[model samples]
Target chain A: MSVLFFELAMTAYLVVAVLFMVYLAGRSETLTRACQVGTVVGFLFHSLALGQQWIAGGGFPVTNQFEAASFFSWTLVLVFLVIDVRYKSHVLGAFVVPLAFLSVLSAAFLRGNVQTIDPGLRGLGLTLHTSLILLGATAFCLSFAAGIMYLIQMRLLKSKHFNALYHHLPPLNACDWLIGRGVLVGFPLTTLGILSGAVGAKFVWGSYWDFSPKQNLSALIWAYYLVMLVGRYTLGIRAKRAAYMAVLGFVAVALSFVGLDALMGETRHF
Target chain B: MNLIVVGLSHKTAPVEVRERLAFKATQLGEVCRQVTDQSAADEVMILSTCNRVEVYAVAPNVDDGFATVSAFLSRCADGMDVKALGPHLYHYPGNDAIGHMFRVASSLDSMVLGEPQILGQFKDAFEAALNAKSTGMVLNKIAKKAISVAKRVRTETKIAENAVSISYAAVELARKVFADLHHQRVMLLGAGEMAELALRHLISAGVREVVLSTRTTENAHKLAEALCAEGGPPVRVVPFADYAAILPEVDIVLCSTGAPDYVIGPKQVSAALRARGHRPMFLIDISVPRNIDPATAHVGDAYVYDIDDLQSVVEANLEERQAEARKAMVIIDEEVDTTARWIRSLEVVPTITALKGHAEAIARGEVERVLNRLPNLGEKERKLIEGLGPAIINKLLHNPLSSLRKEAQERGGRDMVETTRKLFALPDEGAAGDAPAGGDDE
Candidate 1:
């Protein structure tokens, strides 16, 4: 469809993301619910607009950086919605929305015009890798948010300043449990994403192990969370400790996905 | 007149000291008799609860009554002077005492404020005094009025409606945040009554998992069994030394132990948080000596509610209940005044009796003399004169009886009744017969 319409929808998602973050900080359930509604609405429009672009291109819309990025962000929101249904915590939406919104916005700004889908890049492995990574990233973002909330709550308790804001946050135990589960789900999917990316690399570049920065960084993120989970189960590391580690792992994952991708200059080196 | 409560509560006196002065159900009669015999109190009642022992009485000479009760207490306390316990005793007289009784009955003065047991205990004491026939008119009025006031307070206010105890309040706070306890896991640090009671509330609120950690294994097992029976998830006992081992599993931590210092601190909590990856933890420190150090709460993402924090919630709840209680007090006051007025109307019996007696006497004397003078008159005519004497007395007393009743409804009607009785030279209640004699027969 029209680029302007898609950009406007993406902007609406951006505003919703910022609003939800504020809601999380303010601990306003009403605003959070509104954010959730806004997100669902924005995603519906984003999907419709993306579908139009796919029809115009005459294939799967994974041709350029813009289409791939938009698709990745779309997958993230879809994954976040599924998790939100399961966990029923508006808290996850607080983090996932920002990341998804930012990626969509990035796609809008970076890709000014919709172009033809590259026939060579349109493979099953690439689709699987991108979808897995998008979902994993969404779940990891939730863990990251939970970890941050947990740390902030812990500090408030430690300072002996039991104010209204302090009580609004979820308990450390709850945060830890949620983040652990989130990490449990996200970690494997991220590993799969890396594996499938390797498979997709062989399909495109004729190499299974290219040792790219994205690959190396994704492995590091996986290793970080793996240690966090193992430490909790075997050595009796608690929810609080697990949450901190998950947060650290998510940061690593983000660096590998977007931060490293940006540094690598539009996939030319890869 | 001054009112004094020369007694001890759970805080001031030990159980031994309290038991020594305790008024048992059987001894209540004897105690009432002894108190009345020793003092000029027209009204006396003893309120003896497990946590407190108090005697409420009304006297014309407040000082003398206090002195008499103090002397009685001093004598009963053996060689221990009443001065030893004088500071603990609170003295409020007349209006203040009335207010105190109102507050106490309303559960405002209770150690665990808003408990309903005290009001029932108060009622029992009142009933005991009534059975012993020790309560005077004023004391009877006050006791009954206090009960009605307490009823109003309980009914109108939500004071006694919720969990008011510190442990229970902490659990309530957690529930408010979480909404559902059935999926939550709770770790209890001690076998304290307060902590256990809190756990019981949590269990009832749908907490599925309960972990008990105490210094004693026996206590842990016992608590585990009790919790299981109370519908809590299968309670597991964690060793006191294994705080870290169980810390990860529990969603909520309730720390109330007899430790001299902090057992759970920031270092351990922080270590746990880091190991578990910044997970959320809810911690409640209810121990007086503070089992959990204040610093431990700072280890990022842990929400802590201490005793002082919980107290404010309780205080706010109490203030709300108290405001409602004040409204109820007005209702009680009206009820008391109406009851008192009815009691005061009893004094009118002698006046009514005297008026009837005077009218009857005049009718009888005049009729008997006239009957003798008309000895030759027919039996029917003599009977007619006798009947006329009865009619004359009834007609004469009707207006006055109605006026006396109207006066009885007025303030100081007791004085008016006395004046009317004296004008007719009526005897006091004892000489005139029982105050309510033959009134119930019809």
Candidate 2:
């Protein structure tokens, strides 16, 4: 049942992505409304899918790679829907929806990679560690989307090419603000995610410090985002520089979460 | 009835003639009533803008309506003779007129193609005619359809999305840099006509405040006072020497100084960007020989566009508008055909009614003649015989009448109406006179 709902949600997101692309090419209020409706429908199915998973697994469903990726995308869509309604930035969906679709697509492909969590590890500490990290990653995904838009808009501004993409994009300040906000929200959550993960490690692995590749990479990803947050607020590294950092930090996060885990076969830490 | 449009636009008439013929908004209702009263037209509307003054009318005869409206137009303007206005006037009848109205309302026929003001002007003219009760069924339907068609064109095409003027281009560029101008400040360095125009556009876009600085203190103070009187965001006058100090605080800077050298350079802009924590700033230099250093564009987060650059942007946008205008024309053509067909269908109603009435009259007369010969028959039997006559007539006429109605809604439907009239020996007057009334109920 959970798989069925996940597939349904993925199909809705795919349709939303296509609608947004058409809207970007030829802007119309009707198309925007359609995209909004599609997003809401997809979000509902996604929530149902997650709820089904939670009930079936007897815990918050972020234990395995499939559940983690699915949760990441669900949170991304949730944040996008909030921003879309609050800011009335309908065009932002053209950039964000595709990322959500791809995240869910990866989860579908990794469906067989679910690792059964030990019953002893089913506690608040493990749930917090996984859910907080996934939420933080979701925020970074927003920054990544905003960063890409900023670079495209910046190039258009510098080259004086007011093409369709340039016109559809949000203003440079808006993109920069999103990038800043994402880092601001993501950094603290990541800090707590790392701290909680370490606390959970003592109970499960019999030691808090293991120096494993997954643990090392998680620390590296957290530090990278920390640099971005500090550079944006205190060091005056902003606009183009901040956009570049946001993009690079997301790359590091992706590498640590997906690449490092894949390289070390049969890893206990995700 | 024929739908006709008789008037001159900027394309056919000079400004001297157009201005003289333009009707005042307050006088529109009276003028429309006068046209309907004096002309052969049953319905009348006057659309008078600075670029064009057109009279839309539904008349019994196209030639007579055109002549009457042309003469009235010449008389409305003082010192303009009919011979002088004759060369300027243009007349379109039937489908041509409907197509023209759609194009005009959509701004496809505007002097500046794809402008937005013409739609509002068209609506006002329509409202005036409605207020005066000068427009009947035909004019009202056409006018309403034109308004919706204009809205459709605006949404379906990017015809009015881009700025076509330099000052408006500045505003568009500013918008591209700042998501919302309501919180952003603008600084005007020195004074020039184009610079002030750009400043006005920015203020209307909801800029937070305006900072004015000029080489002369008096000019700055006067400009500030004038801007403040406009009742927008507050305007502050800063001394020329202190203008650079507020660089980091302002988001947009407009420079049009008369100085021989550059008033703002890369060093000052880069310093300001650093102080502002690298927030983006838009610099527009409209001064001759340039007021801001061109190299400032290389500075991160600072976009510098000079006069030539702004002009190029306007040119590019105009070209895009022209391309979009072609697309709008296609939409207009499709709607014109649909509306024209619907209007033609109105002509079929009275013909069908007449055809049904003719058949029933013969049936009733024959039934009465036969009943007189069978006075001894029972009451129920007599009623059944009377009903049989009309029932046969109705069944025989149903196919022909329905086909006539169907043919009337397609192209070349007029020939079908004429043929049906000749075949049935129906009076032509009913088809012409009852069309407007039939359309009213619809």
Candidate 3:
């Protein structure tokens, strides 16, 4: 029953995301308000459903592919909501909601048949590891959105396009500041997640660096983020280059989340 | 309703008259209040800027609201030569007035075509009027429509697509020359206004170093201090005569001195380029008397964008944004129609009330007749019949009543309502409520 509600809530969220995109494209303020209300309601239902599942499963809903993917989408929306509240920018929804929908859609289709939770895998370290990775992924997602905005703004400024979309976009200084802040917050969590994963591996498999495909890809993603941060400080990369690096970092993170699991023939975490 | 706009702009009125008529930023609220209190118009809004002073009002039963607003404005100017200023004061009634406002909000009417500042000014004016409670339904509709149009113009038109201002365009040109400005050094050759604006833009663009040189040490020091305080690197105020000496160090030089003759002559420029080893320099000549000699282009690796060249760039940018301005106007037109319709719907109230009144009156008269016929019957029976009669009348009228109530919420439905009332000859308020109807409310 709880799963049913969760699925229903997710469906609503997907619809609301589409509506929000339509609202932004049409530039309909009335529709934008409706989209906000719809998204908020969807978030509430999603939260309620997740709560029910947590109680039913006797753990946080971050166990397997279905739960983790769903949780990732949920966290992204939560972050988006926070940004929207702080910035009061309905424009963010145009970039954010689509990704949220895609995340949920992937969960629905790719992890439909994954086993719920394996009782043996339910430990504090594993939960913490999963949580850190998810949080880092969420931050990366936000940075990617901000990066896309930065790139668009750069292109517009280059081409001398100061149209409505350009005006709606926060200034270059503001975007850089936001992306930097996102990275600043996310970098430590990502570093901690990788370190803790190493520790978890040692406990589970009696080795810290076993060169698993996932671990290797995770390190590569970390290195990409490191380049972004270093370039920003040392080279003083401001707008376009910084944005591209952040975007590249997100892509690397996404690949690590999915690519290695596929290579290992491990559909358990889909 | 006739839409009217009567205003004085910098183009039409002298500084003395415009200043007199101008609603200073401080006095905006007070002016709005005075206009609303005195005007026979159903709505009023005053838009005053350094460049334009406008009074928009909707007159009751007047052919043109423009004359009324014009008279009001003339009175404000205290018997100045209104005719001389009147020619400059363009008047647009009805649709023209609406279109004029749309253009203004979209920045089509601004001194600088496609500049974004007027939109903010318009918003400020509307907010001020709202705060003063001077705006009525007409002004409210116009203000909102103006905003919608401005937004649409920004989105759909090519207007505002480019950097039209010399300062912003200079920054763009700088970017093209140098991929990044983070480490670039900028030099100012004079303490002119144009130079200051351009320098400010460059500093905001993250230019690291700024060196100031002007005829006066006081002016140069002042500019340097201001720039340094704004987070840019500490500025160096070089002596005007030492520009030839300091010219070798900077990557970009912005020149706008007021000298009668060419300040940076061919000999001076060539020698400086030689000393600098021709490592590519960007010079922007914004002075009318032309600070940099025209022959200086012969110097290798130096790219110059003069004032006229910058003006052409601005013109091209303006053309692009002009297309957007039209698109925005179309959107505003649609909003205006929508708002007008909504306002028209206010007419439905009278129609609905009249319809309800007629039904109540008939119901009451019939109940009275029934009571008279049943005078010999018991009081309980009489009360029941009376109660039953109202219920039947209410049920019968429910659909029409609900529809009229709904219509009242729609735009332009009010006229339809008044027509219905006049056709049905509904009685006045006192007669309508005198029906022998039973108690319906708790």
i-RMSD per candidate, Å: 5.7, 1.1, 10.2
Could you tell me the TM-score of chain B in model 2? 0.90
In candidate 1 the C-alpha lDDT for residue A60 amounts to 63
B347-431 in candidate 1: lDDT tens per residue? 4655687678777988899999999998998989988999998899889778877677667655536667777777767777567
List the RMSD of every prediction in angstroms.
Answer: 13.9, 4.1, 10.7
Give lDDT tens digits, candidate 2, residues B184-215: 99999989999999999999999999999999
For candidate 1, the TM-score is 0.53
CA lDDT, every model vs. true structure: 0.71, 0.89, 0.72
lDDT of 3 by residue, A1-270 (tens): 666766776777777777765664542356667767777877777788779868977888888776787788889888888888987866677777778777777777766677754565568877788888889888888888888877786665544444556545665545666678778778888888878877877786688887656767788878877767776666545455667777888887777776666668753341
Candidate 2 segments exceeding 4 Å error: A1-58, A85-122, A210-217, A263-267, B75-83, B349-401, B411-436, B439-441
Name the docking class for model 2: medium
Tens digits of per-residue lDDT for model 2, A87-153: 9888878878898898889889888766667767768898899999988888898998999999999
Number of backbone collisions per candidate, in order?
39, 0, 17
Where does candidate 1 stray beyond 4 Å? A21-29, A113-119, A157-168, A235-238, A266-270, B1-165, B172-193, B207-283, B292-305, B312-442
